[model samples]
Target: MKKHIILSAILLLAAALLYCSGDRQQVGQVTLEWWQFWTDPAIKPTIEKIAADYEAANPNVKINLTDLTWADGHEKIVIAFSSGTAPDIIELGSDWVAEFSSAGQLADITEDVIKDTANFLGWSAGIWKDRIYARPWILGTRILFINRDLLRKAGLGENYVPINWDQLKEVCYKIDSLGKDIYGFGSNAAEKHRLYKKFLPFFWAADGRIVSLDGKYSVFASDKAYRALKFYKELSDSCSMVDTQRRLEDAFLEGKIGVIISGDWLLKRIKNENIQLDFVTTLIPGPKYPGKSFAGGEYLAVSAGSANKTEAARFMEFITNKDNQLLFCKANYSTNPSSKAATTDTFFTSDVNLQTFVKQMNMSEMVPATPQWVYVEDIIERMLEDVLFNDAPVAESLYEANHKIKELIFKE
Candidate 1:
């Protein structure tokens, strides 16, 4: 009740401000508060330089930047919105946009974003209830990384990669036959933010979607979803579920795991480590959806509380424009540019492995855009954990999860 009251007050305040702005626009020195999550020592300086360049172009505008960490950034963002103190421009994970946008804490920038990101991928995540609330800032996709040496030692073909879920299971079991320490697959078990990411591709490839495209209802307990869960659960003997992607990547890099699905960031680490073992990248195997992968992207949104929304919108435009998008992707090699022109840059096309990531991105699916997703995902993850680790029947687990999701989306 208190939270609703606070959000109501914020919405009323935004309404009044929107009316006043229509009457008279503010004209003076403006400082746009930007909250971004690129806090790495290497990436932070690049973001700062972009801001510096934007400031130089618009002498009257100043960008006040705040650094956020992924560990607690979402919590901080929620607190900011609850307290009505959100920054003018804030960076959000592709998955986090729906919650804030649904709360009326984010400004509707649909026209502006559609104009700028016509060629952008993963726009579905930023659009909620048919309105665009955020613009795609950076995009990335995950691919299967194979340990070829491990495959050879397991007596499997060195260059062979699984093309379907059944093939993947067979390969995993083959690697398991190699030794006690060697696992066929590295999987994320019950990790909250990540488990769904690993599971969704299979769910999607099975021709099952979690919710309707319009975000109207739940559609999770389909035969395809049940089969996907059953298949994943069956691989339990040959797979180990780690709690974090870093752990999964580490196990794979140490040659303890034969097959792992990970992002392009892992590629960067592999190049840096310069390991002697030969590894290859390929699309994640799927049944009905052959090469499905998960699409992830960063988004920039303007807060409804911003007194200078026009300026904030311009700032976002400047930051996400093609030139700056290219620059950002160059500095951050793990991400692919969302723009058509930027993808053609030699930075992406010249590399055979990076090109695979691009293909995966093209074949990937964004998570559902429903506001209920935030809560529903918890239910889905718990259901997956129950099925995978607790021996819960897949059909029963998915059916119960669908019930929970329906309640979340339709409850009064």
Candidate 2:
């Protein structure tokens, strides 16, 4: 009888201890679910290390990272929000932020990030209706990558950099005259999501705006748009190889193409692989001088339905801070930190090629922050296809595209 009583008491004590331990864990611990799209084997380790460091600093906080792919991340995020199964934090592409912000699926983080706006770049990418819903993490811009050897062979000095459209045309034509196998310009083909990026810089250079600030109407059918399209079509036809961005970059690397508008990824590839190609980076030549290019990057946002909003916001801010951004950008090697101070570091300033990209990034612009931007970009791509491939009149294509975009924006 005594043995039975003692065993019962011990059992009760063990149960009580277990209960208290579980309760303590529940009270003191916080886990934040972060869904991100950095899946590269080389880069994922850096992300993991950063998360581990953050966890070590905050002992009670845990980061639950979920890797996502660009191919279907948007669709997964939409489903998560609709089902109320969204993670606490999400890494969104610059173009995807509007759809989530407009749907009220993203937490309003203006108060958390407003004071730091001056310290960071590309805030326009994260702001919706004057309210910031995300923090820009890494920024990137497209610049002109020129083959120095091709320029020299064409009788243009190896040091020559085209600063205006006329000079660029002359160089391109001179290079194209070299041979049938070698092209002058690497023009983007009818790629669904890509052709618009290549074409928008020209449109923007000509002072074209896609939609009004209020998002009430389309302002894309102006004389500037028509002129930009006509010029782009002429340039492409005269001395360019129409291909996908990947093929274009490959051609540039193989020294088969003279000039292409490419981003930092190609720069990193060349440097890392020690390619023995003679190339220089320059700002995209415009009608008069260097013009605006496309600026876009990764953004971090807190989910509106996340129970751990405060913790998620803290982690978001921490990861996007200057030091962390520099670390991540350095590891990625193909992106610029969103932090203004981070860019001033010797990592970027010491290299003339990187400096060109930084300069272009400052002059770059993002697409309009509208929820219907996906459809709008589709229309823009189709319009370019019509003019470039179908030989449709530039003005007629612009007018039709403008009408379609207006209907998409103001439809009842």
Candidate 3:
């Protein structure tokens, strides 16, 4: 009996040693932190699947995805970076490419990976100072959205969606003549930063480019910009619902407006409801040039100080790939395709209007990738409201806008 007890004790000790050794080896696996602004119900599941599949393939690594809204995403990411808790992989707006990259908060990815940017639209929007920093997972560009149902009622449904801004205005006049209370065209002219989102599309149609390629200063006071602003004010005079982009989006979902310039979210909203709404998208056209729109997209980046950079980057690559992007887009019904092959998915390729956005991706010009651009945009937004709502003359107002922007940007 004594010999048996001693043998049992020895076996138990050996078992404990083996368990401890195995645990230590497993501890070396990495955990990567990824952040994004995808709180929409349709989007969360797709992102989760991507993360799960990636984790399954990389058993040695773990991905932690943090999702938020656009406003919330910007605020929280700024806070996290400030608090030194930035994630390994961060997905942000192109508008923020300069803000975060300039602060030395992002990893320099120019030479770190092989990229086929030519195959992707808006892929080059996030570059700053000739260095690649973040990569886009999804994108949105401004496009013309017309309601065929309303156009038909106005006796203009015969391929009613126009090819140029002037034709669009003519169509609006026809609709306006139909009723006093109803509007033929409506755009979100009152939203804060959103004004630029709407205005840039029209401005570009006038052969106007908002940002200088050098990323130096605001060109909003240029002749093209003045024409864009003046034209916007004129459009609003006949349109009802001078609401924010959010409201314009909501209004579009309810089929309350005739036409709008909006993002992919509007497409998803209409499709999800199975509304028998007939709609189409077209390029903004100008006299001497084709209409242009702002091209912007969502990007995923790794934090320079993250403990899981490698794992996070790998997850980003997997998520942004064709298979995962297609799955997510098909399930959600609203995402802009990121990968070249993903655009061929029957769900997207079958829709003519949807493809217009994908095509516009090529003609898009990214917003200025300068650290001071946010403040500059703010100045532009406020001045636009003044020009539209107030009696401020265009030239004086723009000069003041330029001066005010210079003050805010240069104010230490």
Candidate 4:
């Protein structure tokens, strides 16, 4: 009996040693920290699958993904950078790339990745001071969302989508005349940062710019800018501006709003909520040209302080390549592929509704790539609110905003 007990003890010790050795192998492997905010219940699994595939292909390297919430993700990123614990690969919002790259926190990948970026609609957002610091991963755009039922009730045909700003106003007024609490258009008011994107298309179509080419001056007080602002104010007056985008969308979903300019996320929400409403999206009505949309997207950037930059870049390239991008965008219905091949894939071309946003990509433009963009955008939002809500003159409000932004741009 004593001999048998000693043998059993030796066997247990050997098994424990073997298990620990395997654990140590995994622990010793190079693991890159990936911080991302695609935490939707449905989309999270797709990301996990991608990570698993990447790990299967490269056994020597592992990815440690930390899911983030949109509400506090930016704050958390700033904290991580301040504490010297930033992740190796970070997924940044379209507006955040310039802010981070300008701070010298992002690795320059101009020569190594996507050298010919003219094909990507939102590529300019990832560049800071003429240096490419991030790769465009997912692209999307806003279109004019129309309520077909409301149009029919207003004695308009289902195919009566506006082709220009003048037609939009005429249609809006016709719908507003329907009475019974129905509104012509739903425009956002007083929402910080959001107000800029909502109105930027108009300014861009009018050939107005938010900043100088060198990004060192504010050009918001130009004649074209004033024209755009005046037009927006007049449109809002006709539509009856709502205090928030959410309210605007809700009104649209309820069939109380005849028209609204909204992002593809609204389409996803409409489908998920199963709202019994007939709606369609089209290119936003333009002034000087056809309608234009905001080219919004997400970007992947390697941290300047990351020890595993090569691995991070490899993973980014793998995921954003044409095939993978097409797969990912297919899963996320509202997302448009950033790659040229993915953009032309049958997945997009086959669906007429999807093609609307895909076609708008040709007429889309990204916001100014400036480190001070956040500050500049805040001033413009206030200017918009002053004219749209406070009844301030468009020219005067724009002049004040231009002056404030000039101070921010030229400040030492």
lDDT of every predicted structure (CA atoms): 0.83, 0.90, 0.74, 0.83
Clashing pairs in 1: none
Instruction: Name the 10 consecutive residues with the lowest summed lDDT in model 1.
Output: 19-28
Q: Which stretches of candidate 4 lie over 4 Å from their true place?
A: 1-29, 116-119
Q: State the lDDT of candidate 4 residue by residue for 193-268, as single tens digits.
A: 6888888888887878878877767788999998888888887886554768999898888888998888778877
Each model's TM-score?
0.89, 0.93, 0.87, 0.90
Report the C-alpha displacement of residue 319, candidate 1, in angstroms.
Answer: 1.4
**TM value for model 2:** 0.93
lDDT rank, highest first? Answer: 2, 4, 1, 3
Q: Comparing candidate 3 with candidate 4, which one achieves the higher lDDT?
A: 4
Best by lDDT: 2
| Full-model lDDT, candidate 3 | 0.74
Instruction: Rate residue 31 of model 2 by lDDT.
Output: 95
lDDT (tens digit, per residue) of candidate 2 on 237-301: 99999999999999989999999998999988888899999888899878999787988999999
On TM-score, the stronger of 1 and 4 is: 4
